[model samples]
Target: MTEEQLQALLHEMTTAEKVGQLTQFAGAFYSEQEDSTPVTGRIEFPVEEDMIKESGSVLGVAGAMKLMGIQREHLKKSRLGIPLLFMADVINGFETIFPIPLGLGATWDPALIEELQTISAKEAASAGLHISFAPMADLVRDPRWGRVMESTGEDPLLNSLFAAATVRGLQGKDSLIANDRVGACVKHFAAYGLAEGGRDYNTVDLSERELRDKHLPAYKAALEAGVKLVMTAFNTVDSIPATANSTLLRDLLRGELQFDGVVISDFGAVQELIPHGVAENEAEAAKKALEAGVDIDMMSLSYAHSLASLIDEHMIDSTFIDEAVLRVLQLKNELGLFEDPYRGVSLEKEQTVVGHPSHLALAQTVAEKSMVLLKNENVLPLDKQTSVALIGPYADNQDLLGEWSIFGKTDQTTTLRQAVQKQYTHAIYAKGSQLYERDEELLKEAIAAMEQTDCLLLALGEGKDRSGEGRSRSSITLAPCQIELARLAKETGKPVIVALFNARPLDLTELEPYADAILECWHPGSEGAKAVVAILSGKVNPSGKLTMSFPRATGQIPVYYNAYQTGRPLPPGSNERFFSRYIDIPNEPLYPFGFGLSYTSFGYSNRSLSSAKWDGSGILTVSVDITNIGEVKGDEIVQLYIQDVVGEVVRPVKELKSFQKVSLSPGETKTVTFEISHDMLQYYHSDLTFASDPGQFRVYVNGSSVCEEENTLTFSLVKS
Candidate 1:
């Protein structure tokens, strides 16, 4: 309904009715603290039965979820009969847990991402949930943040493509799924990328160049996909809480980006502004948030108490309140809730549809494709007779399924031991130490097991709890216990094969000195074990590439391959300490962005540019030859990166313009070509126009994910 229509209808409501319309909660994520003390370190929101009766409607949110009995009772009690929007964090799965988004991103498969979102929405909507907080579109560079698991990785183009596809997928067969296809909520808007020290809810301060170039693309793509809800971030951008940033919320998201969706605060973010020192109390937090464009205040009753009075006092505009509320109601209408409130979901289907076999197949595919073969030193594909010692806590522990995995059954889930034990008769298992262990004796016993085996498959990485929301780590090295265990395995002279199960890339400098083979398995799900077995045994050759750059150390964070070159480029062996290059460690990442090793190898030829210059309308063809020089057949996600010789605005050293994943048999050769135009060359100018200037362009192509070999072609665009 229009805000005018909403206002007329709201004017007919009693104070209690008005209040009810504004209150929403997810009963599942909350419980009263024992001894009447509020829960510590858990999101807490208190709502009384009287408050329930007084509020026009209450949204059953987040953990509270949708329960048929409670929902019916609320429908019966509310004065205005306004129903609540039953919401949940429907990321990956409601019950059928899929790989996290970062894992999904590694697949470079949009159809798979779409399939996951479609299934999640159907399951969420079928369970009577109206909305899902998902497709977390934060584009970030700092891998130290735990929430990186929940997002598509760092490339703006890649993130944008997948973000849009996932959003469209979540809308489901139609607007509503069984009355359950849940609405998608793109979250943590503005510059949540500048998290201070890589911590959650830390301060975010970045330039507009960095913001638009590195961060905003994913949100833009999600918005373009017609995502109807955007959740405000926990962090501030330039000293202003994102939930209370007028430029970001009102002027940009609503006005410039043209998002007509409901703007909701991150859990307790509105109330948090008081602690952030931006607001004096819940009242002021509510006033500032609503005025700034926060529509639904998730979990914080600051809106229920202060917003109504603020409207009366003109401290905040009533029109703004109506506009926000209407956006929420419009979403309800879009979901077709007015006709049958029980639309997308039911208790029975929720039990059956979620965690079904078909969904598990998809989870398996994502897990398989996301595995990056970081390094292989000829000791892999362990023979069946080879006695393998599976050493590490994560080897058999069910908790390493990676983070943000929901409704996962650890018992039903496959561990590395289970997957290998099925295939190889000579596999021996030993839990060397707990994932976070500090003990030394356990490490020794594990080393003894390493001595007994012909080869060692060391499963090491963060636990499932270590890599989701609010789980940032300052030191992203292999936990000390795991490192010592790796050291012991190396000393035994056994072929040490390390399977890394992490949400984000960890610095592997210590492990590389000992390990013969390294696989970034991520947190593969139930099929995780099977996938690991397949890759280790050469049943599946690794093809996935690193979506985010791996830093050599923590100080080099916010480091990616696409940064603009400084005026003084690093002279490799220069003595100038003031250069952008680091003194202790090289400025380059331990592994270059887009760098991933395959079990087999391919070689690239120099790129041949078809034309040196062209008009904006024509296609520019650049062809390059690739030959499979390895003994086995494999696929290559060959990349093309471009650099503008000189531009009005400083451009990235290299930006991934286009890439193609191809297949080749041993000794096979093929010419892979790319078509370019203004689409690939044009970048936004300072004047807010996208223009490709007349200049020399450099094209690089490589068999792997990055173009290490450069071939320059001078190209000029004629004025339109």
Candidate 2:
């Protein structure tokens, strides 16, 4: 339909019909139930039959035939025969799950991530899903926040790159909402990652400068990449709930960012305004959200029950409802739903594409590149003929798919023991202990297996349910029983290799002492086990890096690499008690960001600069020589970091500017070059001005964020 025809249809919509276009319900709302009451969060309210038919969209429902039945029935009662849009939380993958978003970030390969998301889009679109609430752009610095698994990491620049890549992958490079593609929704609008105490749904307090500099860039990148929709956060921004914050939604998101796309609330967030103390009742919640430019209310009745009456009572203008309804209609038309309601949904195609062998192969490659080698004391790359013992809660368990994989099944996932058996016929398996509990019989069996094998590969970490939405933890450490299991295995004097399967960064203080090698295998989706075996057998070298820093202890909750310099900063190896240093522990993380290990070592030498000064408008080229000095062929992620010597505000010690993944044969030498422009040095000032100042800068080129003095080069930025 043309814009004129959509406007004409909008003019024919009744007040109730317009409000219905702004309301969304879940799959269960359309099912027959004895209780006519519908629940949103904790509150239950009566939903009339007509309200169901008038709803603009449905959530948590999929499958080609099922959606066809719902849409066929819905159009019969829609009066104007408008088709309902189907949305789901297809965060990481649709059926053939990939590693959690954090693990994907560890690859430092946005091009690979784009390919993975394209496969995800194809699978999801085949299953009749029109929208995927994914590519979460929240900048997370705290590991205690369970939702960190959904984010790409803590750095704004890297997150922005991945966010844009995700959008392009899901929506297609041409921005066409084609039959094989699904529209992407960049989520949580603003800074939901900075929740205080790292608790889920907690308060977020930050300056507008902080919000703009560190948090808002990724969402803007997604929108700039042509995302079709935006989802509001469940938390507050500047003390106002994001769903009702006019400054955030209207001025920043829509006005300044120029996003004319559809805006929808997070699940039940509109009704949640009452508990947040921002609204007196549901009616007031509807008024505030609509005024704040929220277009659709998800799993909430506030819009359906109050919007028409608010317009009738002159409490709100009817234009708000009309404008929102038009956006909804426009999205449907853009999706080509008006022409073919099914939109190429076919059960045969869904079955053929989802979880296909090619898709699983890609998932395996991603999982292999995402597994970080945190510690290796000559215990990794085990000989294929070596006898190994696979023990712990995850030994034979199939909960390899991480949280937010709504469509992935555990039955389809391969377990560590199964993969080990396939790789090495001399391997034995035992369940040492439950995740959070101890059992003497299980311990004895595990110790027997450990004594019988030449090496111990302990599979341990939080369960699949431990990290995702609303699964925050006060202490981010392994359970005591699992720790004890590791201790007992170490007593046998066999080489202990810890393969950690988790979501967020964990406190490795307890388990670090006993392991000869530690592999941070984050919830590696369907082909995770196969990838792990391949790495262990020397078929694949570990090349993944840490995106989020691992805290030494739970006390270091919000630790990250790109922290601002402090006055009276503690000098390295200094014993001064008066400086800004922790008395109980060192301030450094257990594992810093961009830190990882490969089977082979690479040596850096001879750093050079094109010029000593940049005139602020031209590019300055920096180069360094990297050679594979070890005996094995491997891939290395060379990172480039910059430090602004002086600024209007305190700058980070070092910020990641660029990175490159290079494959090198043994004894091969390669020179990696980077071009730095004036825009790379810009920062948000006290007055919110984003520009670089004339100053001296230090550049470091190495394999990780921690750079040695010899690897650093000095340069200056002069006024144009």
Candidate 3:
């Protein structure tokens, strides 16, 4: 439908139908239960059957058969014949699950991540989803928040790159009109990741400069990439809830960001405005949301129940309603739903494409690349011929696809026991300990199993239910039982290989001492076990780097590599007083961002600069020769970090400007080059101006964010 046709349809819609276009409900309402049975997220709305028939969208129904049925049922009851848009939280994958977004960030390969999203889009589109609230571009600094599993990482540049890539992958070149794609919704609008104390739905208060500089870039990048929708955060932005804060939703997101796409509320967020103490009741909730330019209300009946009355009572302008309804209608038309209500959804296509071998293969490849070998003292690349004991709750568990796998089937997932048996024929398996409990019998059985084997492969970490959405942990340490079990296993004098299955980073300071090798295998999706076993058996090399820092203690919650340099800085060898040093522990991260171990070593040498000075418009090229000195072929992520000696405002100690992931065989030398552009030096000044100031800069090229290599080059950025 064209714009004129959409307007005609809008004119034909009744006030209830227009309100319906701005409202969303679960597919269960259209079913026999109506309001009795609940759908996803357990939110039960008091939706009338008439409202269900006339509603604009369905919340969480997937699979072609179900979606086709619900959509057909909806159109039959929809008086204006406006197609009901299908939306779901297809965060990482649809059926063949990939690693969580954090793990995807660890790969540091946007091209590969884009391909994974492309695969995800195909599977989701075939399953009859018109839109996915995914590619969560929130920059998270605190690991205590469960939703960190959904975000890419903490850095603005890295998050921005992945955000754009995800938007491109999901929407593709045609931007969701294509039959093989689905619309991408970048969320949770602004910075919901900076929740207070890393708790979900907490307050977020920051300066306008901090907001623009640190938290808003990823969402900006996603919008620039043409994301079809933006989901509002549940928490307050500068003491105002995002769902009702016009300053953020209207003045910032829609105005400054120039995001004309539809703005959506997080699950039940608009309704919570009453409890947030901003709105008095549902009527005010509806008024605030519409006035703030929220296009769709997910699972909140506030719009359906109060929107029409508010418009009639002159509490809300009818033009706001029309504009919101028009955006919804436009999106439906953009999705080609008006042309074909079914939109190429077929049960056969869903089954054929969802869990295909190729899709699983890609998931395995991504999972292998997402595994970070955090520590290896020559115990990794386990010998297949040696008798290995695979012990822990995750040893044979199929619950590896962490939370938010709404459509994932764990039975179809490959378990570590199955993969281990296939790779190491003499492997003995034992369930050592539960995630948070101690079982003496299980521990004894595990020790006995370890005694019979040549090496102990302890698979331990948080359960799948431990993280994502509302699941936040005060202490991100391994369970006491698991730590105790690991120590007992180490007493057997066998080399311990700890395989951690978790969502966010954990305090591995305790486990690191007893374990000979540690693999940070974060909730690797359906093919998690296979990829992990492959890395252990030397079939694949570990290449994933950490996007977030792993702290030594829970006290150090909000640690990142790009932190500001303190006035009283602590030097490398400074144990002096009056410095910014922690009395109890070091202020450094246990494992810094971009830190990962490969099967082999790479040596950096002969770092040089193309020019000692350059104008604002000129490019400064930095080059370094990397050699794979170790015996095995491996891939290394050569990172380039820049430090501004002086700035208009204070800057981070170092910022990651660019990086290159290079593959090299033993004794092979390859030159990795990075071009630093003028735009790369731009920063949000104290005046909120985003421009670079001419200054002296130091560039460092090495294998990780906190590179040990002393290869540094100095250059000056002259004014144009």
Candidate 4:
């Protein structure tokens, strides 16, 4: 439908019908299905029967046949025959699950991430989902935020790149979503990641400069990449709930960022305005959200119960209601829903595409590349003939797909024991302890298996429920019982390898001492175990790197590599009490971002610059030679970091600028080059002006963020 036709349809909508277009409810409101996947919470508010037929969209409903049935029933009752838009929390994958977002971040390959999302979109779209509440662009600095697993990582540039890649992958590069693609909804509109105390749904307080400098980039990047929708955050921005904060949703998101797409509230966030102390009642909440530019109220009765009355009473303008409804209709037209309500949804397509072998193969490859070798002491790449003992709660557990994987089934997952047995015929298995508790009998069984094996591969870390929305942790260390198991295995005088199945960056300070090698194998999805065993058996080298910093202790909650330089800085080997340093623990993280080990060694040398000085318009070429110095072949992630020696405001010690992942055979060398332009040097100043200052800059190119002073090269940005 054209714009005029959409406006004509809006003209036919009654005040109640218009409000219904701006309202969304869970699938339960329309009908009940015995086989329906419970992906969302129960409907708390009473949804009137009339309102159900007029509702614009449905959430948390999948299965092509089920969606077709729901849409068919809804269209029969819909006065205008407006097709219902189907949305789901397809965060990682629909059925053929891939690694969680945190694991995808470790890959540091946006192109690969795009490919994964493309496959995810195909699976989800085949299941009749029109929009995916995904590509979570929140820039997280605290691992204690359970939703950190949904975010890419701490760096703005990296998160921004991945966010854009996710959008492009989901919706493709075209403005209109393809039949096999789903619309991308970049979520948590403002600074949801900066929740106070790293708590979920906690208050957020930050300076506008800090918010724009760090938190807003990724969301903006997603919008620039042509995301179809934007979801309001549950948290507040500048003390005002995001759903009703006009300054945030209207002035910032709509005005400055120019995101004119449908702005949907995150899961009853419209009604949450009352609990946030910003609204007195449902009417006030509806008025506030509508005035703040929210197009759809998801699972909230505020809009449905109060919008029509508010418009009739002239308390809120009808223009807001009409505008919102038009946006909804416009999106439906863009989705080609008017032409065919069941856009490409078919039971046959879903059956063939959901968990296809080719899709599973890609998931395995991504899971393998997503596993970071945090610590390896020449104990990895164990001979396939070695007697291996797979032990721990995750050994035979199928909860490999982490949080938000509502559609993924544990029965379809490959366990560590199963994968290990395929490679090591003499492999033994035992569950040392439950995920959160211990038993003496289980401990004895584990010890017996350990004694009979040459090496112990202990799978450990947070469960699938430990790190997603509302699953924050005050202490990120392993369970006490698991720690005891590690200590006992250490005393066995056998090499111990830990395969950590977690979502967020864990505090490994306690477990690091007992294990000879530590593999940060995040929730690796359906083929997680197979990918992990491939690395263990030397079939594939571990190439993943840390996107978020692993803190030495939970006290260092917000530790990151690109932190600001302090005035009273603690020098190396210093015992100064007055400096910006911790008394009990070092200020540095246990493992910095971009830090990861590989099966083979790599050497960086022959760093050179195209010019000693860079003018505003010219490109400066920075090049470095990376070689696989070890006997085995491997992949190296060449990271580029830059430091502005002087600036208008305080700058991070070093910011990640660019990265390239290169595959090299044994004794092969690859020259990686990066072209730095003036755009890369700009920063949000105190006055909010985005421009770079004329000053000296330091550039470092290496495998990781931490580099030696001797490796740093200097350059000057001359005045334009």
| Steric clash pairs (candidate 4) | none
The models' CA-based lDDT, in order, is: 0.75, 0.91, 0.88, 0.91
lDDT of 3 by residue, 1-720 (tens): 778988998888889889888888776676653344333367755678788878888877787887888888777876667788989888788898999888889999999888988999999999999998888989899999999999888899889999999988888967546888999999997789999999999998888888888888898989999999999999898888999989998888888888888988988888999999999999999899989989999888899889989878887789999998898988988899999998888999898889889999999999999999999999889887989999998898998887878789988888999999999889998998887888988888987898898999999999868899888999999999999978988898889999999999999998989899999999999899999999999999899999999999999878899998789989887788899888777889999998999999999998999999889676788999999999999999999999888998888889999999999999999999999988888889988899887879888888878755356788888885
| Tens-digit lDDT track of model 2 for 444-488 | 999889889999999999986788988899999999999998898
> Could you estimate the TM-score for every candidate?
0.93, 0.98, 0.98, 0.99
Tens digits of per-residue lDDT for model 1 on 97-139? 6666777788777777887788877766666667777778888
Prediction 2 global C-alpha lDDT: 0.91
TM-score of 3: 0.98
* Worst window of 10 by summed lDDT in candidate 1: 31-40
Model 3: lDDT equals 0.88
Q: For candidate 4, give the lDDT of residue 309.
A: 86
